[model samples]
Target: MLSTSHTVRRATSALLALSTSLLALALSAPASAEVIVRGTEGAPLHEARPAPGAIFPDEHIVVAQPSPSEVDPSFLGPVLLMKSAHIDLEKGTMTVPLRKGRLESGELVWSVLTDVTDENLANLHGINYSAKLAYGLIGKATRSARIEKDGTFVFASGKVDFKPEHAVTPGDAPNFFPPKSAQPGAIGDADYSPLVQFENGKNAVFNMPMVAFDASEETLNAMCDGAVDKTVVHDKVTAICPRDGTVTLQMTLGYTFGKPIFYLSTEANDPVVATLEGAILTPALNDTPFALEDAAPGESAERIYVFVNGPTGIDHPFRQGVNSALSDGGHGPLNVLGGIPTINLDYSPIWRLFPVLWTEEAIEKGWRTKLTNAIDIENAGAKGIVVSIAGGPPQAVGFLVNCPVVYRIN
Candidate 1:
């Protein structure tokens, strides 16, 4: 559930801080002199991708034998493991059980359960369907698996390390999408937009990390070639997939902003304004509604759609990031270039008189804002966001207030 309350956010922040500190201390401790789970090791994975329909290869299946057991505490993502996997070659595509068709791209896309339950003791926790998985590159991240049935259980044992290179081509199947029938560039209705929303209040901050964008041309660079510009960087290994392309980009973001708030725009050239304008959202579209339309020479219209990172301005106990960009021209830390209309309290005087002034107030509040939008986004479902820029006189006013810069949830 989404929360935008002051107290709720503050408590969460405290918990996060404490957890981070503890993790730091633990990592600094010596390695555990213990044998965790023992089981057959997985193959070495270099690069692989999921077939359009032949995905989610590994399921929590039942086994006649108990897997291994973990001796140390580790995170397990999704319990689902692909019975099949796919690999790439210079020729065409290498078919794997988990893979259905061609694999020409230089990337892999596994619906990796980012983190899993820490059931290291003698006890076992049933599969959690609510756990979220991400499709991306490999990491040291570990997950545990086991066989489950109505009457029996077998622990798959050991922590499963993610490795795209471990994917091997498997036998062919009748259901595999033949190269002749595949839609190369037609991504029909794939969701590529990754968004970040914030919930703020008097003493709370809810930060959602920004995933790779599946929308624009730059998104493609992020997926396949891996590009980093002044705006956003994929320094962290985030699974990037284009809405249209055949291969998925298993990569880490090279850059990041000061906060969770980022810019969003239809245009790619427009400068990004570091202001907490509104929540990043992606309205549903059967086909990408806003394509890259061209502009005439010397025309200042349609420059670029930039999203500066900041907070999601949800209304309820005074959110800071939801302030008017005109209020301070985004002289604040948490801001987005592709800004959105957050605060409905668009009082005429405040906007017309002192746009910069509002920005200062937003800054002094310490990067807090929340937008209340009721889209059909599921808890962990992929979503998008949009922001609108202010025009006319506000541009001349410069900035309102310079507030403390907030950190993004890296």
Candidate 2:
């Protein structure tokens, strides 16, 4: 379990790449039950810019609240629905990690308006682009909501009033978290990222380009519209909406997942073919090992085999079977510990200096192919897969965000 020390130790090579001492035991399960604590500590709401010509209403949203029932959805759709009073740009720059995303689909609606003069009631723009964003979600997502111009971000959650078009019911595009709740599932454990390109205002994009309007206003308004910044969801969550109303646009951005890249050396000696697939992790295989001298009396005394990760149906078998040559009759590919006995990922600063478990440098090189497929490995020694096999594939192996980083101290 993500909560157990044993689980904190072994698992997928790619998952091991995400491991950090700061990673709480909270990551024990794939779909952890909803955990709701009182008080809004991390949930900070930012005020919304008043809709076009509308005056700021006093009690627009007298009661602002994130419904007790939160909604965690996958990274899809045009905009990310949120309930915020006022987002602190300082916070966004200070604590915000570099979020990644990409553009997947949708047309960019760009337009220029011939309306809107000092005292004239004319407001129309030109050109607009609808950029569908696909991403590996990063920060905490806002859920079931009822917002106001007062900049109130609230999650008015209930049994989940879902409509067909709403992004949290049946048929809604898949995203990072589930529906009607913010209990922190893989949305926190996993990475909802999309491939990115340097084009927009900030850094990179997920995988697609944002809907850019040649005129500007059209793009800006569409961004703040419900179509763009109106929802946050995950896999378990579909579309949901008890009602609807029309509104103008504001500002926006989108995302997508990029292709994975790495190099591999096969038995055919094919010049280490470069492969592009999902994300990669070092010590590719579970049963894989590194240390020249296998730990004595079994390394189990330290409570091992804690966590696991990676894609399905991939085990290079470097830790055991015929693919292994690290003595102990284990698999070969994944470079387990910091020892010269085995070859983990082709590149790793940790492998060169430390005598520990895993490192980021190694996994970034695409070594998940050598994962040790199993449920648990208690006192399993360096023989066969050294990683602990908890239950099975469904619960273990997963995409990038689902996979975690791992580490061990000497």
Candidate 3:
């Protein structure tokens, strides 16, 4: 008979293998039944006439031309009138051009049916005609115009002088992390530091100074009325509440099989709290001595903590999959992080922590209250969770605020 530990290891391995196989099958499923081409306006366009010798086996080509108004001129440099277009479905080729003048009256906007997968269609959605015209110019003028999987040219502009200043390349998208081989189920390991321990429904108090937020009358008023402005400055939101009152917020964290559970509450008369939606937070090791303020006593409000992240925003594939799986009983897309090669498992339990920031609309309108008793962590598995907090006091009087907290559970 196998030892208990050995049996657990075997079971974990089998489970991971089964999960991987299921994921592969789901990814390999066939595309949608029909192919359609619609412009940004949601209207169907005319189909493209294939070239006499164009080759497409068991596939067709779909095409559409969006009006110049539909395109964002800031990203595509100068705007030009679309003149002509052609697409070869079998060859996986698209050719379009934009002349320096206006399109003639009664010009036909064409569309075609193609066998492209839905994933490719999603990436191609809202694609500007000017960008397509730029790609055509690059293909004709440069030797480095390699077409990407989504039918757009990569960053290799070659000798093409038409590269736009704000052109978006494939690198702009979120980079996924590779999946790791699941290890055997074991008790607490030395890899993760213990942050909180819960026993008999009580948590071991771990007191840390809370990150401060600037307290202002504007912030307080915004909070009271349920409005918090999301004005971004330097990729950060800077709104502070006056510290004229006292408030305390607590987040209860628990874990089972390497997943997280969160319960949030506050002691203020008017409770204002924020918790991440569709993400989890883990402690960042090697950071300075950091602790969340367990209690806040009203005093002078000058400094406030702000949340910061990348300008283009961050994407956590595992968290996204969890969110989708909770809504529907199926795993979503497989986001293979960095190509198909060596998988890194070092960043599995840690994420950069930040405060919840508000948007302009939220600041203008009174803040909305969002309270929850528990978070579903069944689908989190062993991947790192990146939590995104929402539902904080509005912009004016920002006194006691509640935000998401991270903890490590064995």
Candidate 4:
């Protein structure tokens, strides 16, 4: 759980993201849940512009020139939703359907958008593509699910408890190194995980958010309408509506390959890590490891880049200000999410936090502050300019987080 002040700020942000009717209802209610509305953070979204193009004769060559219009979703362009989900950029809220399914034991499984297995479904959902999902087919990394006659998902396993109260108390000022107490609001059972390998002959594992367990649709809808306690929703859930069959969640701001991005923080294997990322602490995920190299065959893991000596302060052009070795009192190093698409492509909700430590010599020579590109930072490590914090007490603790990339800011 966030401090009271943080909660208030988050609530205020959520209130601002909602419509007037919702706002009025919130005022009438003693308390209302909040969401972390995104979109306008880090940098402004640029208008789509036409790129210069050149035409080549078919007889000579058929080359497709790079067009500005070819930009990916986020700062690139609008994403088409195959599902009934709606993303409102102005409100920084994405209202996606409150998808429901069931477990083999007849336990209810509730979920939400956006990732899927099929490429066609990906286009329809406006989600990222992950061919690696095929690898999850025969592993402990994925849970099994089947589709019912009415299109409801029936899972073989996986259940979550949204009742836990989340709270986190950062370490005393200066450098909030280790939080005093950290508790994730929601928790999952031994069988629960986001990676779902549908037994419906689908070859892809649908990496989506599992929002609830064994909860009736009617109860969820009532919670959405504020007729009942909203705690039934995850702490990260900002708003929910059964009428619209949509649930709005909060997103965290970060950078991916030097580009500002937003992603959903859902679960973390470590409690402290969960608190820091505003995610649920799913001990069930303890089955996963910190590095993919150590994972069992077919196990899924993606790298989440972090800098140990990046520039500090909010004004620096490349300022992430997450250098743990530095003494600026800023806590939690800036986390880089996902891979550089088309380069070393592997995008999944599952992530392994990888830290880049600037060598003392490099720090002495002042070589680690302003760098931003992922390749450049890794290259610095390869060149002995920096090193991994392996085999020693780290400047900052590293842990895994399940944060699905949502969109880019700039």
Candidate of highest TM-score = 4
lDDT of each: 0.21, 0.19, 0.21, 0.57
**Candidate 2, which segments miss by more than 4 Å at Cα?**
1-193, 204-234, 238-410
TM-score of 1: 0.18
Against the true structure, what is each candidate's TM-score?
0.18, 0.18, 0.18, 0.69
**Residue pairs in steric clash, candidate 4?**
1-166, 1-167, 82-124
Error of 1 at 104 (Å): 10
* Maximum-lDDT candidate: 4
List model 2 lDDT by residue over 73-185, tens digit each. 12111111111111121111000011111112222211111111111111011111111111111222111222235523222221111111212121122211122321211
Per-candidate count of clashing residue pairs (backbone under 3 Å):
91, 151, 60, 3
Which of the predicted structures, 2 or 3, would earn the higher TM-score when compared with the native? 3
Candidate 1: stretches off by over 4 Å: 1-280, 283-321, 331-410
RMSD over all Cα atoms, model 4? 17.1
Off by over 4 Å in 4: 1-67, 70-85, 88-91, 222-230, 286-299, 308-334, 340-344, 357-371, 383-386, 391-398
Candidate 3 local Cα displacement, residue 306, angstroms: 23
lDDT of 3 by residue, 231-334 (tens): 21000112222332221122232222222222121111011111111111112112212122212221111112222111121132122222222232222211
